[model samples]
Every structure is written in structure tokens, then in C-alpha cells.
Target: MPEPLDAALTKVRELLLDPNLTRAVAAGRRRGQRPSVVRAELRPVVLKAGRRLQISTSDGSRPYTRNVAPGTEAGAAVDALLAEPFGNWHVETADATLQLRVTKSGEAQLHRAAADRAGAEPSGHDRTKDYLLDPGDPIFAEIGGSAAKRRQVDAFLRALAATLPDELSGPLRVVDLGCGNAYLTFAAYRYLAQRGVDVELVGVDVREDQRRRNTELAERLGWADRVSFVAGTIADAVVEPAPDLVLALHACDTATDEALARAVRWRSRWVLAAPCCHHDIAAQLRTRPAPPPYDLLTRQGILRERFADVLTDALRAGLLRLHGYRTEVVEFVDSRHTPRNLLIRARRTDGTATGQQRAEYRDLVDQWQVRPRLARLLTEDAPGG
Candidate 1:
């Protein structure tokens, strides 16, 4: 009923040896395995010495890569990986595609298909160098992270990179608010620095330990002169020379509001935030009745929480518009990696909100009778108030 494991392994070997093999990825770790490698990928590479097969493996957070001649120990290691009860194998060659899934009963199920006609080479970011955080970096190895964490960092960087304006002149000043652990802070510094952009980076958090540890990390990376950490609340953190870019990743609830308000106050050219926890609005919704014709919106606790998340972000985006900043709310990472993946990117623009935009924002707030923290923070001294 199923292909023999040896037969599947033989096919894998053939594919691995094929010069036309574009990419081969093995994922889903076997239970109770040593080294804890969760995923691996094989790709052909041409080195100065000669052609080699590059094997990249991720032990969850950290990624490592090595190359070896075909039919050597490295090749045997790749073959052994196929025999493991890894969940899935996806292989792509110039002419054919192979998909294999391992069943709980240790049987191999294989599927084959014609390779889709090649299109323009797919556009992609280099996972290692393009990101602020690289799994292959010494910092990641020191901190101990997985492939998934690396993906999250890459996703966030991709979004931020997309929002960056083309015009640039001088050193970029960046402030990371509520930068707990400062993983992304360090990453931002690395990304900008690698691009030959002069960067002045500061990470702000409430914890003194985090500040001290991040400061140490910066010193180790030889970035102490340019990148430093401070211990303070997002609202009170002091950044000198005013930041051109303000970043807040997963700042919880009203804290996110504080970060945005701080950015607006500084007139920062760019603001990127990934808000976490909609507790404040969710709490407010519990005490207030929903508007007519929309009572079903918050009928169930789960639905109420989800609605609060959307309402909170929508209001935040609207308020950004009201403040003359173009804004977008986008997914920061795959939902499987983290549910709190929404990123709000705002860029200062010459345009301001129209009368209708302001009226709609006001109406929504009035109808819901919920005062968003961001609105209150941004509009505390506005005309109506």
C-alpha cells in the first residue's frame, strides 16, 4: 500500500545527486532526537575551491551551514536525514517535483508531479544577511534561538525595509521603544550597518538587567559607540538627535500607544510597531454595550477579544492618518509562528487627514464609546479637547 522506505530513500538520493535539483527541504523533527535539528535544506553551490553540496540545518533557532563534496560523509548525512521519521520532504528539480510524508506508523508516502514551468527567478531576501537577526550569527548562537525566531525577524525586517524611503543623506538615527531583550534592536543595527548606512541606534526598556545585557552585547559586537541601551518607560525614554526611525515590536497594549505617541512627538520620519495584547480595549468593551446592529460583534468572549484587536488597530491607523502619517497594517510573520503578528508601519507624509477622515474616526469612537489609548495620547490637547 505504501512505497518501501528504502525505495523512497533511493529516490531521495537520486534527487540529491541531480544537478538540476533547485531546492530540497526536510522539515519536521523526529521526536527524541539528539542535536534537535528541526529542519534542513540542500542547495547546489559553487565555491572557489570547487562545486559542493551545501547543507543548512536549523536546530529550531540557530542555523548552521556546511558544504561537502558529493558522495562524501556530508552526502551520507543527507541520506540519513531521509530515513528519519521527519514529517515532510519537499523536493524541486528542474523537471519534476517530489513530495514525501512520513506516517505515524513509520510508512513513507510519496507523491510526484511535473515541475511547474520555470518563471523569472523568484525574488527573495537572503535569510542570513538581509535580516537584522541572522540565525547563523554569533549573537544568535550565543543567545540560543531557532529557525522560527529567525523567520520572525526576517519577516519584520522585510516589512520595515519595504517601507523605507529611497532618499537618504546622512547617518540614520533609530530608537527602539520597549525593546525588551533587544534582539530586534541589535538586528536593526546590524542590517543598517551592513548596508553601509551610518546608524545611531538606541534600545529602551524598563528593565535595568536588559539594558546592561544589551549594552554588553553591543560592546561585544563593537557597536557600543553607536548602539546603546537605556532603562526607562517607552513614554519617558530619552533619545538624542531625534530618531529618524522609531520601532516598537510587540509592545503590549497601551505601551504601543505610548511608542507611537513618542514617535509623533519627535516627528520621526518612520514608525514601525507590532502591537501585542488588546487588553485595554477588551476590558473597556466588557463594561460598555455594543452599538445597535453590531451586538453580535462582541457576543462571545473569543469574538469580543478578536474584535477588540481589529478595532484597536483600525483606530490607531486612523489616528496616524489624522496626524499626517501614511500608515499600513500588515502581517509581521506567519500566524503559525506567532498570533501577535500584525505590524503597523507609518511614514510621515505631507498630506493630512481630510475632514471626512476625521469625522469617520470621531464617529467610530463615539459609536463604540471606547477611547483608544493611542487616540487619547495623540489628541490630548486637540481643538475639541
Candidate 2:
């Protein structure tokens, strides 16, 4: 049993008006929602224009900010927001804190912080990321990238570094599949090198031109000994030593599946893929009728497209789990930078899929009648198939 949403939101309203409200965040999108806004934060700001509430939303790659007067439209917007089935809310005030979390089974839990506890302070970016490539570095300047591009690169490297296991010994071998410009490839090598982690990095792309450009850049950066580029498809890229980490950023359509399948075959310890495009599944959905009671999902082109994206990702996660990987689909960055910011991060786990997990995967594919590219790639002779 939990308090009603209206009641919880009333408390939110009260906290929002409090002068001491330090910060507030609402996140965890509802199922089938189209908005790339997976997370949003609210803070008070007083500009020369007027006093307003700064609402910022991130699709996962970049942040977009909008100011709203604390008036009728703001109240209506908050009301509409509360109507969304977002799974978590955190509101911090000078004297207290309000938190709400909804379980996967739809049970809501409320938590309150002690009155004496101070509200959480705002966090700032780490200016002293000595291990990371500086934005002002000649390499970025040579590439003629914007400040925002540098920020995205730094954020991505920080995330990748966080996922590295501390217990691992020896130099890290990394392969960047579909490494178009190899910005991230160079950044990864630089980040690891600064931390005294010996690294062997290879950037693979289908285009020989990109390979040549990246190789020349690596040499210019004085990393020719440890970093190189190869012209080949992600599915067939050859590296003498297998990679410990396989990265595929913004790999389009079935290319993402190919990268993941390669990681599985190579038994890489970590896999990170930012998928782009959902045309395959959407095309399949258009060719056949959706199952009964779900016809509304495919009744409109936009809804059908959106539904396919969700289903495709869901099936990919399930298939990854089946392959003995712990998978999480999370916002890779804010949507402002790129809408295709969803990241599927899979780390090899100790256990294989349970029978229930396999059954669920089968059920979804059977119901949708859409064979995901990853499923076809990873499950040709799957256990219990």
C-alpha cells in the first residue's frame, strides 16, 4: 500500500515552492513513451528576464533547458508530468527530503529524509580529469570539434573508465567497431594511457579512407605504436590479440547486432553499443498485422515506429541475457546531442540464462513475429533453442 499519486504530487508542489528546495529530479520513462526525455531536473533560477524554474531534460546525450514562470502553465505542466508513470522521484529541501520509487510490479514506496539532514548539493563536472583528454588538446583542435563535442567525448570516456574492472591485470586491448571518425577510439587510448594503463587500441571501419585518416591522426598524436586503424566490416575485423572491451558507438541498424555478436563470439569482457535506427523492425511490423488487442500500436505510422524501437531493444537485452551477459539499456547522453543516445552496456556475467528468461524471449518474438537481427545473430544454436 502506498500514498496516491496526487498526494505524493501535492508534497512535490509544496517542496517546489519552498525557498530551500535544493534540487529535484524525475526519471525513468514510461513504457512506449516517444519523448527522448528519459530524465529531467528542476532548479530555481533568477535571470535578468525574470524569476523562473529552470527545467532541464536529457535524452541521454545532451541537455536542453527551458524556463517556465511559476504560474498556471507551470502548474499544468507539473500536473501532466505527475500523470506520467515515471518510476522515481527525488526532491530535496533544506530541512527534509521526499523520495518515491515504483517497483517493477507497480508498487510505490515512499521515503523521507531526516529533518536535520542537509539537502544534497549540486554537483559540478570534474575540472581535474587529468586522465581524460583535455578539450583544448591539439588533437581535438586539429579535428575542429566543438566544445560540446569535447564534452560528449569526455563524458563517454568517463563512463567507459568507470566500467573497467579494478581486478583486471595487464594492458587493456580495445577494439572500436564501426569507428567512423575514431574520436572515441583516440580518446579511449589517451584516457587509459594517462592512467598508466597500457592499452592496445584498434579502430575498424568499412571505409579505407576513414582508416587512413584515423591512422594518420594516431601517428600525429604519437600513439602509432599502440593505436592503429583497420579497414574492414565490424563482423570481420581482425585483431591479432582479442579485445577485452568492444565498443560500437552509434552503429546503425543491424550493424549494432553484428558488433555485439562479435563480442559474444570473442568472449569480450565488456560490450557497449549505442544503437542507431530501428528501420528493420518497423518494416516488419508494417508487413504484418499486429496481434489482437495490440492493433492500436501499429495503427499509426509514428506509434508503430516507436513501438518497434522499444521491442527491438527489449529483444536485444533479452538475447544478451541469454548469452550470459548482464545487460542494461540506459541513456548514453542527453538527447540534445543525439536522439540515438540509448546505450546497451553488457558485461559478462557468471551465470547463463534461466529457463524462465528463455521462455520470455521466445514469447516476445512469437507474439511480435519480428525476428530481431541480434536474435538471429546470437541464437542460431542457442541452448534450449
TM-score of each: 0.66, 0.64
lDDT digits (tens) for residues 1-385 of candidate 1: 5776678868977887787776777754322332235456787788997878888875433457898786666568776776555555777777787877655465678888986664524421132345454443444533446787778768877887788855467878889999998887877776565455667888999999999998876654445667888899898766676899999999988999999988888888999999999998899999989999989989999999999999999999999999989999999999998899899999999597899999999999999999998877876763210
lDDT of 2 by residue, 189-249 (tens): 7666545576788899999999999887665444566788999988776776778899999
lDDT of 1: 0.77
- Candidate 2's TM-score reads 0.64
Segments of candidate 1 deviating more than 4 angstroms = 1-134, 381-385
Q: Evaluate all candidate structures by whole-model CA lDDT and list the values in order.
A: 0.77, 0.74
Top candidate when judged by lDDT against the true structure: 1
lDDT at 221, model 1: 45
